[model samples]
Target: MSTDQSQGGGFPAQQQEPPGLTEEMRPQPDHGEKSYVGHGRLEGQVALVTGGDSGIGRAVAIAYAREGADVAFTYLPEEEPDAEETANLVRNAGRTPLPMALDLCDRAACDRAVEQTVEGLGALDILVNNAGYQMARDHSLEELDDERIDRTFKTNLYALLWLSRAAVPHLRKRPGCIINNTSIQAYEPSTTLLDYAATKAAINNFTVNLAAQVGQDGIRVNAVAPGPIWTPLQPATQEPEKIEKFGDDTPLGRAGQPAEVAPAFVFLASPADASYVSGTVLGVTGGKPVF
Candidate 1:
């Protein structure tokens, strides 16, 4: 099983509503269901992954389980089926799985996610703020409405803050870490996804600053900024034309798959591997630059 697989990028035109499902995507993304052999790097740890029902979240949850971590994850109510599948994968790997149907835009829900993960899984060692939101537009200035901006920021940025704040005390005790899911769109902003891009750039700032503040307490903070990856988010949010070309802009000449990006999270969360690594962004960008 390899961590990095070239997906050959282009996809047949498809569409779905917000918070898309894994089953609906054609050529269904490989969430490391068969690939990603782990070496017990995260043994005995417990992790809370926002939006773990599918895409990078599912892949990360699967990787964490295989690495021996008990996992709890959050998803939209509409994403229940996808969440169940992710839960089954964790069980198959001999770990606990807690799936919560949640809309993370609520501050209370963010706090609850951490509390439940600790109570259910026994402890919280890794927190992956991987849930995000974005929508493609034909005219960014004309069509980007207040509601769209608010939802994008609330989901992508505000929830990250709420969750991390709630998780800090618990993490300090275990000397655990936080890994926010950032994006290539941060550095290379998309004209259409203005709100989403802004939040990602803010996340980069937040990740580094939080790492510094938490380091004294033995808590590490970092982020992973992925380039165009073939996750359900593409079809659900992007314009058809954009989805058709997808990751071709990358030097790799194709978009990446969820499986290919999971290892970066595992590496960042691994104490033996990343104990001294903090306040940095790991790029799984298919030849795109994160810096």
Candidate 2:
């Protein structure tokens, strides 16, 4: 599926690719440029969202910014342009944006991202552990290489652990919240994405346990498990044939947009709507069975 269809020829066809930047997407995902209306749900708050340069992360950043929060995000080395565009959208929403590039798999880098976000944004009120990667392998566990398994765990699980640990102290001080991005695969495993499913399951467990530990400190921990959304990751991770029919089997006939999953983050981060909500997983998987 070429993501380069022409829109009306005036504004250019926006890219709709998953896991990639809004700029590169054929029909760009909505950033609520003029659509999303905010009423100060998160005013005066500060948020740090990993992978905020694109996809669901970008949607959350824009929503947070619209709600009057300063946002900081981390992206991979090669994703600078998309990262900047996300920042610009935040600024356009009348909020501050701090764009940083770092490899979350590196413990030191994760710590640095936390520290820099706190220093740059003044205070961190919300932390969104949204960065992740996966590879589809048809091999069984025995045939899976140790290296691939290790990498998957490192990126999807360990990175969240390290980043959350680093952010906890700062979060504790402000009674902040943490929102982890999990996957529907955590509940229903896909044969091809064995390692990815395992990591997501770990994330689900981590969110529950961490919420219990942090509840006393007034820190909330939660997760969102999204089945399949249109993002750059689809094309980058799956085969073209799979990409063409993405989300076709879901209860919703078509795939979801990034905008649809982002409001869950906004509600979880905002005290107004989720003061009593923690240790819960919001399933945004297009009416898929979560239980």
State which candidate has the highest lDDT: 1
Note the residue pairs that clash in candidate 1. none
What lDDT tens digits, residue by residue, belong to model 2 across residues 1-291?
A: 012222221222232323455555555555455566677999999999999998888888988999999999999978888888898999999999999999887899999999999899899999999998876624477767888778778889999999999999999998999999999999888888989999999999999999999899999999999987777676666665666567776776666777778888988998979999999999998778777
* Candidate 1: count of backbone clashes, pairs at least 3 residues apart or interchain: 0
Give the per-residue lDDT of model 1 (tens digit) for 1-291: 574454666788888988788888987998899887889999999999999999999999999999999999999998989999999999999999999988899999999999999988889999999999998844657788888888999999999999999999999899899999999999999888788889999999999999989899999899999999889999998777777788888898998989988999999999999999999999999888998
- Model 1 scores a TM of 0.98
Q: Model 1, residue 145: what's the lDDT? A: 82
The C-alpha stretches of model 1 lying farther than 4 A from their native spots are 3-6
Report every candidate's CA lDDT: 0.92, 0.83
| Per-model TM-score on C-alpha atoms | 0.98, 0.90
Position 79, candidate 2: lDDT: 84
Task: Give the TM-score (vs. native) of candidate 2.
Answer: 0.90
